[model samples]
Target: MKKLTTGLASASLAALALGAITPGVAAASPAPSPSPTADAGRSAGPAAPIVSRIEKHGADRIALLGVAPWAEQVRMQFDGGGSVEPVTDGRYTFLIDKTHLGKTATLTSFAGGIEGESIDVALTLDEDAAPGIIPVMPRVLGVSKDSQGVFVIEGTVTYDPLQFDQLEVTASTGGMPIRSVPDVNGTFTLTIPAEFAGRQIGVQAHLGNKSSAVDTIDLLETRPNTASDTHPLAILSPWAGAELAEPAVTFSGVAIPNSQIVVTNDAETDQRFATLCETNVLANGKWTCDSPRLPDGEYSATVTEKPTWSSVTEQTEGSSFSIVHGDWKPAAPALPHLSSITDSGDHLIVRVVIPGASRASLEVGEHRDEQQGINGRFSFWVEKSLAGQTATVAGLVDQSVGKALDIPLTPIADTITPAPLTAPVIHHVADEGGHVYLEGTTGYAPFEFFTPGVIAKKDGKLIGSTELTYNGAFILRLDEEYVGDEIELFSTRNLELSTATELVVAETEKNSAPETFPLEVTSPADGATVPATSPTFTGEGIPGAKVRVEDTTAADKAPVLVCGADVLADGTWSCEAEKPLAHGEHTTTVTEAPFWVSAGTPTTTRGFTIGDADSDDEAPIVVTTPADGSTFLAGSDVTFTGTATPGADIALHLGYGLAPVIGTADAEGDWSVSRWLGNAPYTATVIQSKNGKQLSGAHTGPTITPAS
Candidate 1:
């Protein structure tokens, strides 16, 4: 026998007899088999051919048959005829190799007279393979119903198989089919039929090989219709039938939720409306409408609803009311009537009357207000420009308005005038110098004066008539004239006219004897030296005569010494020198009895050095001591000594750093100062002053050091 090929092993073994069979021909049976059973069994007729059977167990083994009932040795042949030891007791076995599971195989047996029997069979192995199972039905999510009693089904489905072909859905109600579909996600729409509007239904989902659990859904009828009468609508404010302006009239009211509103005039024409325009009502219930201003006439407005009560209804018969135009009347007593308007530079006043009215209003341009006065007699201040210009005033009564009346006026001016004149009188007298004095007076608000004419011939033969002052009175000084020379005095109010007033004039020489001298000075003789103390003067003339000694250089100059009257009783004149004079010559003049004239031409001319020593030079010496550009600390002692022309008065002036400082020097040419210096540069100057006048020379100094 040949070894079985790998391909045929499985098929060949599996086709063999079951485990109960034995393999190979029966062992050669003993020839004496007949004697064994005695002659009765008669010799085993030609030893029964050794018979063998083969069988397979599980999938890996094949059994072979043995010859005797319990024969042990047995052999088998596979499809390729290869022999293999097999199990005894009629069992033969071979593994159905996985490699040959799908191939065909044959097994044959050979024994005695039993011809070879061949068994051909296809091989099969139990398989553990499992196929994926997936659901084919879509998930039923939810359902929706429309007013028409139609139902809409919505959901999604999943199919994982590559060859999946179709899906189907079916929905039923009370076991009655309602809808069906062939695609997974496809929708199914159906009407429940009017009879089933409020009924319940069951829904089911199906795929090719699977069906989903059933779910229940309910369908409901559409909302019921709302009744008009149950929802009352009222015109809360501008009540129905109210009439208003055509361009603008407001109407307001309240209504039920979702209710319809309509408005119209008597003619049934719709009026424009707005719900927000109405006030005092909830948003869901309020409404307002504006009507065009009606003509000046009567009309009616109506608010209504159609189809009073039906589900689909019409507007109602509106509540109707009458509207009439408003009575717009002008208030009484029209602006007061002005007859005329006049003004002074300051104010304008108007004349007006309100006939039968007690109070009236007056208006200038746009101004108006009630004015008070009985029978409307009122006045108003008019502006200056309104003067001489026309203004209008209207008169009104009850419902009757009147037109305005125009008025005009003029202003006045002011003036002034002059007064009259009067005539004057004259008087005359003569003095010891043969001079004549004439005086006169004029009678007028402010009197005038005139020069009296002298009558050389007593008849006014004066060559020229002198014109005197035009003021109240006059005085004339006439020079010497012949004694007893018939003089006349004449007065005239106007020089151009020949009018005159004359009085006999007699020239009498008064105080004929020459006046005696009243005073003379005896002390401080001419050219005498005087000290800085009070200087005295003795005078001899008339006892108790008034006298005065004046520094001639200081005379007629401002700031001169003024003497009191008592200084003259002792025939002595005295005065204190306010300032020291330099060592030099100075002249002092004396006057007596009267102050206008000098007694004898400065009776005392003197030269005296106010210092202890004297020098002859009259020219002032320039001092350079306390030298220029010198500086000292504050509170430092400073001395200045300089020699100048003999009679020069040297005054040292201390100035604050470029500013003027006040100080003084005595008659001697020496100066010393003990002053604290300020905190700035300073200048020191030497000044020569005499007779209230000064001459200065300057030198600057460095800034003073402030004391620590």
Candidate 2:
């Protein structure tokens, strides 16, 4: 504006630089007037309260210590009010939320006004509270220190815990505290607490908060510091001793330098044995352990660990041994040894001698051989069948002190035998028509053909014998019952006898007979009494003949004539009489065979009546009742009666007097002749066929039977 006043003072310095570039121009700041160095860092005495110490720096940061550094804008709050924006430097890293695990967090930090730090951090996100504490050790796989100074700790206790309590178990050369309890699958059983029995301990374990790091186990009872005229630990042999079959037994001793020789067997009750080889007594006190095969006897060898303070003077007073084993001894009753034996082909050799004995035990019957080898001599062999035998040789003189002696052998009978057959022979001939030819001679074995007695039509057919092979031969087939036969040839091991002189047979030719005719009863055509049933015996032969019906008064009876030959197609031989003929007067005989010109006289004969067994005396009134063999099927129903004869006329007959007389018997004589009697065997003869025939008498009416 020194230009308008310089252009209006440059527009009033561009309006105070557009009012300090507008925007409330610092709210027109007239209030900072009482500043005094920012009011001495503002504080209400207690507002100097940031006082922080928010430690917890692992698992996503926290460390906010403050005595003044302005606590770097802290303000963390979380526990679902979820704030955590802190971290300007006082170290606050808050992303929390692992579901805010057991949360509770605070951390405030007001700036210039001085209220700097406030802290209450907790959120640990449970990482199992830093777990991983598994240490409970006591591993002694197998320990042995026995001489009575006692050392037996067999162990295993890895990582144990289940409310675990007492277990300090220490042992470097010193150990004790074996109380245990872990059996529900956790497994722990400790036992070493006999007040630490004989020291050397150094094993450690102590659980609960855990502490286990030392493992040295060696309570070696004794056997190391030797001096003062040593040699007093003798068990010259017997950790395990027995010499029956010999192969194991070596327990030598003279210990002092760490003495331990224990070889027990006062019948061992758990003196726990197994220590096959330990020897360290060398200052000239010798020691050895070589026992494994033991089996026959008594033993006791003791020196059981001694040397801790030393005190065991040349001890050796427990020996009661015996292992006499070389069984099978019994041969001094004067020498004739070998009592029995046998083996034919594959090797069976025997030779025996046992005077004193080096070794000998051989029994064959029930097989026995105690390391057989008697220097005087002995041999044995037997595979399967000891033909007929016996063997016994028992001689054992020193099998570590046990003596034996016996001898006996005898086996005989095998002289090579089996052979017989000299010039065996047989021959027979007829060759052409009826075929009869046999020839033989064999040293080969195997031939047969025999027959004896019962050869009718040609006199006793005898071939008697011929096992052959030392001479074999065969052939003979004369049909027609061996046509005029005559056979006899023998040779089965020298029974020599043969003969078959030109036999011949051939003659057969004759066949022309089968045509006869004469069996005629045409229908009911012969003494007809047509209805008690079954009647059809027509005739004419040879179309397959065989027709029979003979009741010539019953007894060995003969019924079969159910017809065939095409009934009437002309070669006519009809049949049908299976049953219906009892009322007396039935002489129906129709036999046929091979043809039949009456087949020998009776191809037919019919009389049929079967209705007269009823002459009434009160029980015989079965009128014309038909069924003991009634096969009449044509229109069925045929019942007729006749028993009311106290006065006489009870006439009823369907066909007995032959065909047609249906009913008549009223005063309770009961008459029923229901018609339809068409098919065959009918003879309803309650006769009196009518007044003048006279022989037809018995008609006592009403009796229609058959329901029971």
Candidate 3:
């Protein structure tokens, strides 16, 4: 940004000085340096050429250059290309292929064959109509005026239209330019007053940090578009190419008000058809719906919008999104707008457009109300007298709070008497993993919440708070110390919300009931014979407990672990046997041991026979490939080969919770299925009927770990 001593240009600076080109070097002083550092003892040579403007002509650049001695016959030479004699005004044109963009090019002026200093300029196509910068002018397609004296100018963008922020239209003679956002579909429309009619209007497109050349069009009046307040269905949230960590998604977008919007994803066709929600568009012209859970992969949702009084429906494909494990979904910024205000007698119902927000807050004066799990449209109720006041709106989505927006509220109408408050009632209660979970509903306003709202108080001491959502559902978790203590639950700190409800903690922390079946086998019921010795074992037990089923058939035989699984939060567990058990009568014992305890409780002894060894059976089913302890690399095909009874259909489950890959045994009693494996570990299980079913199915080894 150094400034050169202002010296007169060689009458060539008008064409040599560049302006407003993007990704540009800061504009240096147009005059040549007057420093006497070079050739001090003799006549200093001619100064290097200065580039003032660069015009794009197809793939070539017309550089308006400046030289020190305009009258001298100077040969202008460009680096990596041949030179051309510059006109008396110093205009140098050269072919700059697409490859030359962003590359540095040198220019030197030769005065009487003595080369002067050389200057370098970075080649760039980014141009603006502003002085010193060139451009690719926009094209104006049509112009018209409506009956209301509004002038409309429409145009077609030849380049990437979706990336352009705005297009400016102005009367070329004299007037302020009107700016309008260009549609992503390569078209734009701008409206101005009748003052600019019959004038040649210029159009310029502006992108981030760059602008296009000014293109002009004769603004002759024509027929105006007759459409009312209407817009195409557009999906604004979960924008193009978005990736999400969670499976469930909430699709939202803008459409014409009252337009019926049906949204469907490209997953589970049957469910997609049956679960489509109609008329998702709210009164604010924003539509949204909670989507069903999707599996990990790339997916797309399409919206079909059907307007009232129209039999035709238009469908638009939304952007693709990926459901990836552990990937974070950043919250989109919400522009909360005051959608509507209704007089509901007792209160003023104010609905705001808080798109993509889970929690919304409406603040007027000093009072504020917040709603959690907000959907497409969130409404806030306030006193009728508070209408016409400005309110600040905010939303929280994806754990990100959006910028607060202030919007003016409309005047409210009539009002009525307020209802009396009632105590909140608890409906369901349970104890799991030492914590009390309670679901309840309150008779007070659902949107109201305080710092210690819905509190659990022990002996008048503030303890905990829970929120009652818009659906009238509230859950509270208490510590083990409150298992038997009597606690009072109140709706708000002011005591105006609801009366206190007194209750005692029914159960917590322990599930040591001896009469209940603490541990039992759910699958392969106790006495029923199983076709496969390596069968999957699943059962329910107390939360936080670990269950292990071990074979103790022999009096002095070492116990063999048939299956082991930790109880889930919901008291369910399942695991498979990596090693096949020998086919014979076997007695097993179930042990339930909570993680916090040292000893495991022994349940009833269970006996089950495998394969009915006494009956003459067919060929034994055995897994041949994926030997025990075999390792696989990512993307490798994991092929499972096993022997099954001839002519029998086989179903093989490669890992837990996975659907079985079905195959048939060949005439020679061989069956195999191959699937691509990711970087993970898996233990397999194969199943068949017990009639002609062999009793063993496994790799007969340890679990296979795929290399990371």
Rank the candidate models, highest lDDT first.
Answer: 3, 1, 2
List runs of model 3 lying over 4 Å from the truth.
1-177, 183-193, 200-222, 228-620, 656-659, 666-668, 689-702
Better model by TM-score: candidate 1 vs candidate 3: 3
Q: Best candidate per lDDT, number?
A: 3
lDDT of each: 0.35, 0.34, 0.50
Report the Cα lDDT for residue 416, model 1. Answer: 7
- Please give the TM-score that candidate 3 achieves against the real structure: 0.28
Q: Least lDDT summed over 10 consecutive residues: which range in candidate 2?
A: 1-10
| Over 4 Å off, model 1 | 1-147, 150-196, 199-223, 227-230, 240-247, 268-283, 304-311, 326-708
**Model 2 RMSD to the real structure?**
57.0
Q: For each candidate, give its TM-score against the true structure.
A: 0.16, 0.13, 0.28
Q: Rank the candidates by TM-score, best first.
A: 3, 1, 2
Query: Is 1 or 3 the stronger prediction by lDDT?
Result: 3
